[model samples]
Target chain A: MISSPENTAAVNIHRDDIGTRMGIWLFLFTELLLFGGMFFIYSIYRFLHQNEFHLAALELNVIVGTFNTAILLTSSLTIALSIAAIQNDNKKLSVILQIMTLVLGAAFLVNKYFEWMAKINHGIYPGSDLLLSKKPGEILFFGLYYVMTGLHGLHVIIGMVLIAVMLRLTVRNKIDSNNFVRLEAAGLYWHLVDIIWIFLFPLFYLIT
Target chain B: MENMPEQNQKKNNTGYTKYILVWFTLIILTGLTVSLAGMDLGRITVATALLIASIKSSLVLSVFMHLKSEQKAFKVFVLVALFFIVVSFVLLFSDYSSY
Candidate 1:
């Protein structure tokens, strides 16, 4: 190996593609376990109160849930496409796709806001007096609904911010065809968000 | 290690059409789950919805997340994590169901 200034700089930068990707995957698994705990609690409660679970699920608007699911799904597609575009050296297309992803994520959150407000307006929030008057099973159902969906919404915000950062990097030529690990990592995070919603939509809105 | 290039050497440029096809399939699966929700399938509805969801997640994992092209170590790590989750589920259910 020849000792040189450029070699020293390259070593200092240290682009370890395989290691970076593996680290992200490990982080993602921890995230899965974090939500997995909640899913377990929900299953146990649902089993104990099947009837209330069914009736409480009816309060959710399946149409809105489905529409939001589609939005997240489309967002996942856009992020995936952005990665592909970057991999193909099409920087412009990648930026466009990332913007589309951010738009779709915002759209999903808007729909969620309206859906939550509709329930809140009817006094169905976690500790509202109206909720207190409901049966224990129904109360538990709504409580879990709020907590799970709220946490998922938080993940959406984090993912959007990460993608936005990646967009800036892409524009600055920090993320390009030969150096796109950051963008790929961001894409993985976004897809994981989408996957979580895939299970959440069916479990919360479609199973009843 | 010192002489390694800073640029990533991964040249696998998956086409746009493949992702679109996967997206189409995911949409169809989403539609199926929603439509099935309207029916009174009793206990089977849960199973059907979850099964479809599992399929959809697998698609996202393998394709969109690039898990398919990832190294064997990544796949093994994923399986290990999933195995632990399954074990936890089984243990929790065994205790609760027995009670």
Candidate 2:
């Protein structure tokens, strides 16, 4: 059987890097449209209630949002660098960069926690009495705010878990310079998360 | 070792310089957006914010996400997805704008 040409071709065809990558890209497109639908909803609501959206946006801290944006962008850079490091056969550097990406992701979430905490302390969370007492437009604004940012935050956590798995694979030599598509896929996911925040930051925290 | 393909030999040789440069550009864009938010852009405020965000996201898509180096098929798929998204936005907004 080992000598048969049919089995040889079958074995050779078992690994398809391009196919794996294309699969992830397809998954990413679905992710994009998922958030794109939310963005569309946000735009319509903002258009319907421009003044309330503006006023509600002002309640958010621009400084915190900008800082978090910077952190995510930096994480994108670090994850990209990690891919480059792994490609260039610098395993140690790749792992370090992956760790840096995780740290930045954690920092972004930590900032988000504090921001949400501040809002919650002020009784501005979803379905809170203070929020319910607000105008309908204000309620919608905060409602979208919590849903959109909360979903993006969830993606950040998922991306970190994916990266952590890739890190373990790298350590075990399952993903090395010769076969780093897993790491690349993980990086792509992280970048998508960052891209989502890129739009979310402005729509929610800016444009006031 | 036997399963590694020839494509694996053609590793993604992207350097760190490009990533760092993109990172800096993104930071500057973030600063610009924040500062612009303070101005009284009126009706164009959301447009401006969105335009800048689009620019930043494109940069991330091309550089960080490796779309620039990806296959033509990937690019075409992205364009198709984006076209559908644009269609949805235009269709939805047309309804809202139609009185």
Candidate 3:
């Protein structure tokens, strides 16, 4: 299977080569910087409107936020284990763990759905219709809230697609001990999503 | 296949173990951060929470993602990205705090 020109010579290019892997890390690092900018903006606004932000944050359901945090943490563990399984050349185990990770990710989205539903039901939305009957600053806080978490949720969706692609690669025997960079890349993306939530949990749910 | 390096062999086993341990530690840290949030420690709360999050991100980057094992050039790429980010934050916040 290593017969391709990319697989020849002392420097292997069997999908897990240093160059390809570095490319993936470079991609992930760019993603980190992108989200880092958004986070910096959030922090600036939070600092400026600490009282309003905290009051707005208190309107969120801590129960749902905590559950989503736990769910994402478990999913990160599953993805890490999946990568480990691939490195050990355990194909079936890797696939199983990937599917488990996918399930956990979907569960997180579902929990988020209910959380947003609760928020909507309580009238704690953005725009002029926002609840929490406070000041204009408080309404702006919810504006940032919807923008940040909604963008984060969109990232979670993108991460699920990335994981599915990795799973397909695994099923086709394209991933193994000699070539698992894609899985590693996807895992890095998933962990970034988890890290984003780690910040979001405190910013939106616990700041009060 | 017969002449694989011993370091590779050690990496195949111990590396995987270390990743699993990091995962477990992350989960524990998540729970700890959540509980700590309940204490209402004022400004320190967000700072402490973000500090833990940074550590968790570092573990994931270095271990499960194998950033620590990468080439110096690649490490420099990441460091450069982070450096720019910090610079931007500093500039922005300086303008912010002045207002």
Candidate 4:
């Protein structure tokens, strides 16, 4: 084996691919567990106060929750398509698809804002008098509702930024067809976000 | 952005039509689950909704995430991760089930 710099660089680059994917998967696993722990709390609380949790869920807008689910689902599709475009070396289509994904993400956030605003306007926000006056179980339900959904919303923003960065790189030819796992990694993260929402929807909005 | 072979390798790209098909199926599933929630099916509603959601996410994991095309080692890791999540839930619930 020649110990030349070129040989080392080539091996390292290939290894880096597998290594990076493993790293991202590891990171995502942690994220899943983090939310899993929270879901644990949710289950315990719901079991302790099934009635209140049902009431709390009734306060949520199933329509909005369903719409947001659709938006996230659509975004996931667009992200997958964008990766396919990149793998096919059609950078233009990849960029276009990415832009569409970004738009869908923004739409999700926009709907989220309106949903939260409606709650706030109705004095149903965290720490509001209505919440403080509720039974402990109901309070916990809403608290977890806000916290979990808020965290999911944050991930949406992060995912959007990631897609945007990928789009920029694709446009600049930094992420080409031969090497677009980074974009695939982004898609994976986005799908994870969608997956979390899938569970959250049934737990929070549909359990009634 | 790692994982490229030294020589450019041609990876199988899922067609746009297939993606659209998966996307459509996902949307239809979403609608079904939402409407299922509205029906007064007692305990069955929760079970049914969750079961449908699980199906949708499975479609997403296999297609959108390309888990089907992924390496065997990676697939095993994913399975293990999922197994642990279930284990954690069961173990933690054991404590609460008594309470």
Q: Every model's Cα RMSD, please?
A: 2.5, 3.2, 3.9, 3.3
What's the residue-level lDDT of A117 in candidate 1?
A: 98
| Residue pairs in candidate 1 whose N, alpha carbon or C atoms collide under 3 angstroms | none
The CAPRI category of model 3 is acceptable
- What is the Cα-based lDDT of residue A113 in candidate 2? 98
Please tell me how candidate 4 rates in CAPRI terms.
medium
On residues A21-55, what C-alpha lDDT tens digit does candidate 4 reach at each position?
77788898999988988898998899899999998
Give the Å shift of residue A132 in candidate 3.
9.2
Give me the candidate number with maximum lDDT: 1
Ranking by TM-score: 1, 2, 4, 3
TM-score of 4: 0.92
Report the C-alpha lDDT of model 1 over B1-97, residue by residue, as the tens digit: 3255533334454489989999999999999989888888987999899899999999999989988877788889988988998999999999899
Q: Per-residue CA lDDT of candidate 2, range A1-208, in tens?
A: 6579987786565567778889999999999889998999998998899889988988999999999999999999998898888888889999999899999999999999999999999999989999999998899999999999999999999999999999898888888777888998898899889889988998889867
Off by over 4 Å in 3: A1-16, B1-16
Task: Please give the lDDT score at residue B46 for candidate 4.
Answer: 74
- Sliding window of 10 residues with minimal summed lDDT for model 1 chain A: A10-19
CAPRI category for model 2: medium
Winner by DockQ:
2
Write down the TM-score of every candidate.
0.94, 0.93, 0.87, 0.92
Q: What is the DockQ of each candidate?
A: 0.73, 0.74, 0.48, 0.66
Query: How far off is each candidate at the interface, as Cα RMSD in Å?
Result: 1.7, 1.4, 2.8, 2.0
lDDT of 4 at B11: 62
